[model samples]
Target: MKAALSSVPEKQQQDSEFLREVLEGLGGKRKTLPCKYLYDEVGSRLFEDICEVGDYYLTRTEASIFANNLRDIASEIGRDALLIEPGAGNCEKVEALLAVLESPRGYYPIDISPEILLDAERRIKANLPEMQVWSEVGDFTQPGVWDRLSMIPSRKRVVFFPGSTIGNFEPEKAEELLEMFAANLGTGDGLLIGTDLVKDSVRLERAYHDSEHVTEKFNKNLLSRINSELGADFDLSLFAHRAFYHQLRKRVEMHLVSLKKHSVSIADTRVDFSEGETIHTENSHKYSVSDFNQLLARGGFRPICHWKDSADSYAIHYAQAI
Candidate 1:
């Protein structure tokens, strides 16, 4: 079971530019790293592990929703609608959908990790041999990836974007990306989105700052990645991982805070940080029901159905393109 893997054109160049822009924007203020940089191969695997942890309720909660409500979801979309999943890491949630969905012509899994994407394709094919599987390896935020996806032979397309990945984007960018997705699918095509609902500060903090500190390692791994890929000299030990809920922003901000003043060099680029200085890494924004609905409305999506687990800690929203 072999699968072809090609480097997306100019991926390296795009990555370099992305790093430069992000680092420069931080300026002398708190240095920052983009969340996208956190998914380099190993990081993706660690994230999968994180999802399975007892403290991380987002994945399991959303999975339960799909498990319980998939029949209704499938009925709404009808049979023969194409299933497309963005950031379809490992296809665990997609497998749940496939189990309930009536016979569909094809399944499209889009992701940035070639290795994971191919593995997902192999696993899905083994389980559901009748479904034709196609894979694309590229960032979903990038243009033209959808154009290539348009080649898939299906008239009605329904996109499944689980994992609350939409929370990674700022409100504006989230809306823009949703609009892009809505435009990509034909009329009658819809989106199934998972969103983390607003919750207490303590629980939110614990979710990111786990007792075993795996999330800490996940956060600092970004520096390790920079050291390896960009030829940077980053002492991962000099920094400590910090994650907290920002009540005003309604988000969790993950940072690598310097324990003491340190200087690091990446290639010819030199950066210095003072004691207590931090590098902003990632933000997981929590949304209220009203705020989330407004976002969907702005993105031209009409909320059709929403499913919540017992605690109502998270929500799985099924929306249609308007």
Candidate 2:
């Protein structure tokens, strides 16, 4: 079987990368890990479930904005633009936009998962056979991953990032990423992004710590992944998920706490855990509308138009590289 191949460099690359990141994070003084690791197939599926939960309104609110404003967005983007979406996930958001854009030169959906990318490509190809579907499997955070957008001649480039995923990045890092977008995209190129706005702490807390415990499973899945990929002894039952909004940081932080003092050996490294100790898993930073606009300006983007739900719970901003 293709999966039985024992000598693939890509397979080795993922394992090596996971091992390196785990060791560094576990050894760090803060005992924190990167949120990006939480997207193994199961984690990804859990996230999809989180979106449907009534408490989690980011997806629903943003979807409403798109539904009401897709035509205006498409008009600004114009026709024959190369639509490039980083972290394309299941490509549902891009699909909505594609429906409105007239005669796009190509549809390039980029994601870290090859399986998801292939599925997205198949669906898009089946639905919109007239447009080119060039799906790629790679990390979009890296510098040159987006260089391909320039290759398709005579088409303006448009970068689409939805799902309030930008909240995952710390502010400074977010600015850096937006600047990278500006650098990669040509003059007059547009960037469409969705972001969660700061709101009631209770509602925000409930969104991450959902009633069905799906979010808990999603957070704990990171350890399961580490155990599977690296030879690690992670007794999943000994850890519990916890999420809370940190008002000072304007972010909701998720952690996996140890129920009892324990130790786990990851490869040759043994990491000790004290009772009640935590491994910080993820942070979703909420932003005020004006604060986010300042961030976009710092990233060399000028916000041209935006749409938000009546409650102002979320935002979809269309900005251009300045």
Candidate 3:
């Protein structure tokens, strides 16, 4: 059965917000772009390609952790528990987890894109014939999602947040997001989070700046999206992809550098770029297990236990809401 997608009524606001953010970010002294805008339908497809790129180890590494520790992870989650993945948990990942869950109550996978969420719903239901699934599509942080979650009845609700996506949030926002997850959870509810650990800068840099250049395309797609949607005139050939690891900040930053001086007009707005000027796009933050535990504490969660891969390049942690 196809699960009904709980749509957030934001279709009207999405485009206007995108344009506004693009204008605002571009006008700033240090030119930057919203990272979320990089996941349009086109960009989303490119991201799927990114996951398959050989240098992008985060996906494969986390998969190995789950594959190796599925039983133990399931035991921690307990029986008849409702599993909620806040964002981006695909059908295959959810099905794999559900396979080992002890009489799982249901699964709620929320994402902003209807295209992906609906497809995920079909695939998940196809695989788990009897599983209860509620897929929501929209900004998961909004009140609509909060209500949707609190309304569901279950013995335990565990937010299965994987993929080290939380690493993308700034520390303050990370704590706020965790607190939001904590607020949605009742007593005994859990946050199963995965994070990319701090590692050698060389490996970290290569992960984002892959040899296959898929990451480059992933980064450049933002410009293509802006050009297509906002009526912006950007020559994709004039921009080059740049990514590097910042060891002190423990993050990898992605940017698009202008190869020559230019001005791209977007719906009557002229944004100027100098030769070698860059538009900061995204950052993937890494964390040590202890540092993340401290973050969880601030975010109203108590770390229970964590699972790590053989080399400790990544970690999956289970935390209880305080």
**In candidate 1, which residue pairs get closer than 3 Å at backbone N, Cα or C atoms, i.e. clash?**
none
Model 2 gets an lDDT of: 0.86
RMSD (Å) per prediction: 1.9, 2.5, 1.9
Worst 10 residues of 1 by lDDT: 1-10
Q: Sort by TM-score, best first.
A: 2, 3, 1
At residue 234, candidate 2 shows an lDDT of 95
Candidate 3: stretches off by over 4 Å: 1-9
Q: Which digits, one per residue and each the tens of the lDDT, describe model 1 over residues 1-322?
A: 2235555766677668766864584465657777987887889888998887888888888888878888888888778878888888888788867867788867788777889987888888889888787777777777756766666677678988999999988889999999999888776678988999999998988889888888988998888887877787889989999999999989999998999997988668778889999998999999987789999999989988788998989998888898
lDDT of 3 by residue, 1-322 (tens): 2334333554447778889999999999999997877776677778878888899999899999999999999999999999988766354566788978999999888776778877787887788888888787766666576577667788999988888889888889899999889888887789999999999999988889999999899898998888887889999999999999988889999999999998999999999999999999998999999999999999999999999999999999999998
Error of 1 at 251 (Å): 0.8
User: lDDT scores for all predictions?
Assistant: 0.83, 0.86, 0.86
lDDT of 2 at 271: 96
Runs with alpha carbons beyond 4 Å of true place in candidate 1: 1-11, 25-28
How well is each residue in 1-322 modelled by candidate 2, as lDDT tens digits?
A: 0112224896798789879999999998778888998987788878989999998888888999999988998999998888889888888888878877888888777777777777777788788877687776677898655766666674688889999888999999999999988997888889999999988899999999989998999999999999988989999999999999999999999999999999999998999999999999998999887888999999999989888889989998889988
Prediction 3 TM-score vs. true:
0.95
Ordered list by lDDT, greatest first: 3, 2, 1
Q: How far in Å is the alpha carbon of 44 misplaced in model 3?
A: 2.0
lDDT, candidate 1, residue 64? 87
